[model samples]
Target chain A: MKFVGCIAILAALAGTALATEIPQADRRSGYSFMGPDSRAMQDDDTSNPGMLWVLDGETLWKRKAGTAGKACGDCHSDARVSMKGVAARYPTFDKALGKPVDLEGRINLCRSNHQQAPPLAYESRELLALTAYVAQQSRGMPIEVGNDPDLAPFVAKGHELFTRRQGQLNLACANCHDDNWDRKLAGAPITQGQPTGYPLYRLEWQSLGSLQRRLRACITGIRAQAYEYGSPELVELEAYLMSRARGMKLETPAVRP
Target chain B: MARPVLIALLATAAFAACGPAGAEGLLPYTVAGDAVPDSLTGTKGDATRGRALIVERSSTCILCHSGPFPEQAFQGDLAPNLSGSGSRWSEGQLRLRLVDASHFDPATIMPSYYRIDGLTRVGNAWRDKPILSAEQIEDIVAYLVTLRD
Candidate 1:
């Protein structure tokens, strides 16, 4: 009995030691990778193009839709008050689905369950607007998604995917984001794959995009078959990334070059 | 049973008519151990052209490799420096590495310039054709061999 207890203590210590993949002091937001022009754009909402989607989302929150004739505003009230720190804890475990769902998935769930509305398409204008609006409420709040004991298995799966090599190029997410961040790839900086900002504006895309879109682009970049949007794999990856970004400030609706 | 056999034979012939999958545009080459002993284009490559490709964005060589290219301001730090690759490897070894760097490290980020098969989700523009042509691969190999220091 004493030996078993000692083993348990050792295991807990190991878990604590392994908790941080990147040391807390070394963690840098993707915003730091941007130049002055892009940083200035994010700092001031008026110049930021992503604010357009956030504005549209504010309108849709009040406008009633679906068979239940409800607006997201009706139940939630003011997003600023109700949704504060909500986005920081997302890709939360869903009891009904017996898995986890991202912020977009959670919105779709609410739409289907409460409003009786058909789930919005992935990457749709409506979804992007609503997500941007909701996430924006949590801006500057530190992420806190790593503490759930139930999410341990899902987070483990996500870590496996992040470290595992895939596609024709056979490179893992860790190969660049973990091992070679802050280095230039043909003059382009490779930032740590932090999930602090999402539903964010990208100059390359010339529009707002979700994290899943970025993940798909990376997968395709490596010549690997990208997982379908909203797949369990993507949600798991998002959960893992959020866990990695725990304690980092949220920068939703961020502008990126 | 005879009809089933005939149908199977017909199906095989139909697939055979399309030529081997992913081998249509690729040039035939031999791999002996860790190297390709012959030039993929049957002739020597132009080192001058090869140097141009290494520094050019389209070739994507310098994207993951930093070398002795003095003119290029930004080069990558992902792979080993290209300065002494010639001293470290033989011509054939360099050729194989260019053809497929995964031959040495399976998890290498370097794309196979001359290989076409065993790849997935290749962009529409990159399908069927290898990332680099046989001549381009030979040129790169030629230039890589010159970096002796």
Candidate 2:
């Protein structure tokens, strides 16, 4: 299964090689930066702290909610069977809203639109758990967020945000993640800013967090005002990142330092 | 939608501008071309004190810069090494770089240690104040100038 995953990634890389600054041969997962202990934690579901949230998500999936009193399972049935490869193609264009909606956004939309429940609060434990649970079904599948023509403008905006310098420090996301990703910053190895393993556990955060949360932290680290959670800017950025990591294998509920 | 957010941001920035200045209010300094020839604090800074600040983790100097301090085992490699800053530039130039590195390169990741204006979304704890005070900038400049090799 892992070998098939690698070959699929390589094929995707080969197809998009000319378009990216990082060559296909040079592209690496953030997993390569982890030490042995972190790798062990990610490999073992029992020890991975993120699985706790995934477990909670499993419970939430079956529980009924809202005015309709309908559970997610009532419509989707078994998530493992229904949700397989679902996460790999997320932050997809929503025809109703005419914008991209991530995994969390889709879930909330399902609640309010179909189940008649209020949208889940961004960054809340309940939302995180549901997101983690959904994403986990696609674990080891290559991320396949397609080049939907509708997403191009938003992806460009996200690319602009990634490259444009901001904040008192006057640094861009590209400076650290693109130009100097291999170097160490105060004993911490800088990863290539891939969006593979999220809603993943972080030792620093001591909790599972979304990609938007991590993005806000980076913006703040450079002394910039972060966009609000669930903001369009953040969603666009997330779409761009998932597109950027198009070929990488998903490692949802992965552990990280 | 963006306009309201922009308005709110501008208002916040304006509010921060009206907040208390640095530790004892921002001391004015002269920028002569590419350098601030005058020390931020009128008095000369102590190199010993400056060295202590650079070596300390809280100051964030060594966080992105590896320096001549052998005692500190973990230094960053994100920026240029700080072993020969003295030999490369004048004391005045060092002062300006420490004060606002973006003056040299607009996109530099280095923080403006003594600049308070034109910043966005500064936390309450850091608002209205520069990252480093005049004395601290002077002290850091003093230490940087001593790094001949």
Candidate 3:
């Protein structure tokens, strides 16, 4: 009994010796990564490169397409009113398909099912333009997804994927983004990695991209075999990211380093 | 006959596929600043080469590590500082951490440079290959040992 007590004491001391801590009040956005110049670029309606895509998307919204000759505007007119709060609730579970679908998937679904137009390829210029435009409508609104009962399973799966370790590096998304966020890496601030401003312009890619693109970058960074666009793992992971950003103001077309 | 058992096995397999599972059974080693098995060419390590590799993006050591390198312009703060690291741990300890920090702490963010087992989703081009050669590990260890007050 004495020996066991001594061992337990030593174990407690060892735990104290490790300086790791799960910080309280760990709120930070990807905007924390940018400098004044980058922030200015994002806020400025004229200078922001994302606005250029937004403009193109606005044009696509009005232009008629598909064999049915229907524009996105024909059914859902004035996206400012129709698309409000829509982008904030993405990666939601699709009851019809029994899977989680992101804004991109919904966009493609509309094109195929309702618009009678060919689906734009993932990560394409056209797709990004449309996604950014739609997301911009929900700007300043808080993310409100994951409340539906059908989405609970995907949300739980997303939580598992977020916390579970992966790749050759044996890292979970939570390890860095959760544990070590508000820190710096290679001069760039490591925010909590919220996906609020996705389809937002990234200086690294020098182009507009999707949330899946950023996720792919992280997977590749860890030397993992990245899944192709629209993989189940990616969607589940996206669901978790959206959930994490719940109640946070959406910042579509936001800029990042 | 064993229908439930088969279902259980399949469930286990599916669950395992969902996350990265590092190798089973820890590699045994002595602690307290002992000698590491020298796999790098049995030659003196070059600290200069080691420093070069650590800062390079391809090495990716700087992604989550901040060493005693101010001139490099940027470093990560996720891991412990490498500055003055020699005084904190022995050469063997440092070597072990480089080879596989997971051996010490399973949840460590540090990658196992010399380990190939138990890793998931490795690219086809680099499957079965270690991230760093034994020589590179030696070089990094040498450079890290030079960090002092």
Candidate 4:
């Protein structure tokens, strides 16, 4: 049922996040954003479309790579145990690279350094499979990222961007997630825009997607120029979102509206 | 940026209003039962044509808004029903709501149908132009004004 119906009007006015105090309710996970049916879809792994990607990722995990022709399984060996908590701990601070790296970034690093394979293009089918597969291991684990002192600067930058409003719409991420997390927009419920369910399946897409894709959609929804994939701003925003959702459970391959 | 430069940059960009003032500068634009007086430029609006535009993919009001029609499929739930909007808002208020609803609610998902400034990620083809033209806004407004029960 629509909140504002055919006869019952008086649609609730959108409020400024700046004026409103951030409610503790805003800390809710993305699961709150979904409808009952979607939650059911997520509850049953067999029905979840993201499982399709996970299955492929499982295959790729064991498949060999270039030059050395090493599969991800060769080095990591038994993702069920070895890859445990890996997704939860990203975007990790890379001491040598001197920046935080997301799950996908770490996967690429492993490919070039160990497998000697060229990096996969962002959002490629194989990349999505591998990411969904890898992230599946950490499913149900609490996100434990953005804790390192080395990641402080990047996390701070993410905060800046989250609050910064821009575009013709003049909206910031915080406007929805912080000010109206429990409020309904149009008919859709708003969540804190948490990153806990990324590399997740969205029924809207009918396919698996990376966190960057979701971020891009949000930017476009606000009518702002989306940062390019792998851009510093997007990466920093990812780190910040992960930090924001520090204690939320990772629902990789999550089903969403 | 390093601390000093970062602070300087934030100072300049943060406090600045997202969009620049129109020809009127920073004064809030007026909303009422009529078209924006000076900016309207006297283009006559036709309700007949406005009716066509509402469902047209170009104007796309129906993409998110449902009623005020018998012929078109009762569609989307993203916005309020337009069936009795004329009874709810004054003609001037309707005009202003379409021109730029954001002025009232900063976080409204409703697009500024007739605003162009402070926009990013706009396609190259439609850069610097509002979604609906001045006459089109008047046309839609004309049509909606007649919908009063």
Could you tell me the C-alpha RMSD of candidate 4 in Å?
11.3
Q: Tell me, by lDDT, which candidate is best.
A: 1
User: Please, what are the lDDT tens digits per residue for candidate 2 over residues A1-257?
Assistant: 99999778875753343233566567677888999999999999999999999999999999998999999999999999999999998889998899999999999999998899999998899999999999999999999885799988888888878876666565678778876787988868888899998889999899999999999999987767889988999999999888888889999998888
Error of 3 at A58 (Å): 1.1
| Per-model TM-score of chain B | 0.83, 0.81, 0.73, 0.74
Q: Model 4: per-residue lDDT, tens digit, A1-257? A: 57557224333333233445344344777887677898999889999888998999999999999788899999889999998888988888899999888888888999999999999988999999999999989999999876799998999998888877755555678877776566545335667788887788887887788999998888876657888888888889999888878878899888888
Q: Cα deviation in Å at residue B149, candidate 1? A: 5.1
Ranking by DockQ: 3, 1, 2, 4
Every candidate's DockQ is 0.26, 0.24, 0.33, 0.18
Highest DockQ scorer: 3
Candidate 1 residue lDDT tens string, A169-239: 65678878887789888778999999889989999999999999999998887767789999999999999
Q: TM-scores of the models, in the given order?
A: 0.81, 0.84, 0.84, 0.77
Q: Worst 10-residue stretch by lDDT in candidate 4 chain A? A: A6-15
List the lowest-lDDT window of 10 residues for candidate 2 chain A: A13-22
Model 4 chain B poorest ten-residue lDDT run: B23-32
Candidates 2 and 4: which is better by TM-score?
2
lDDT of 1: 0.85
Give the local distance difference test score of model 2: 0.84
Error of 2 at A231 (Å): 0.8
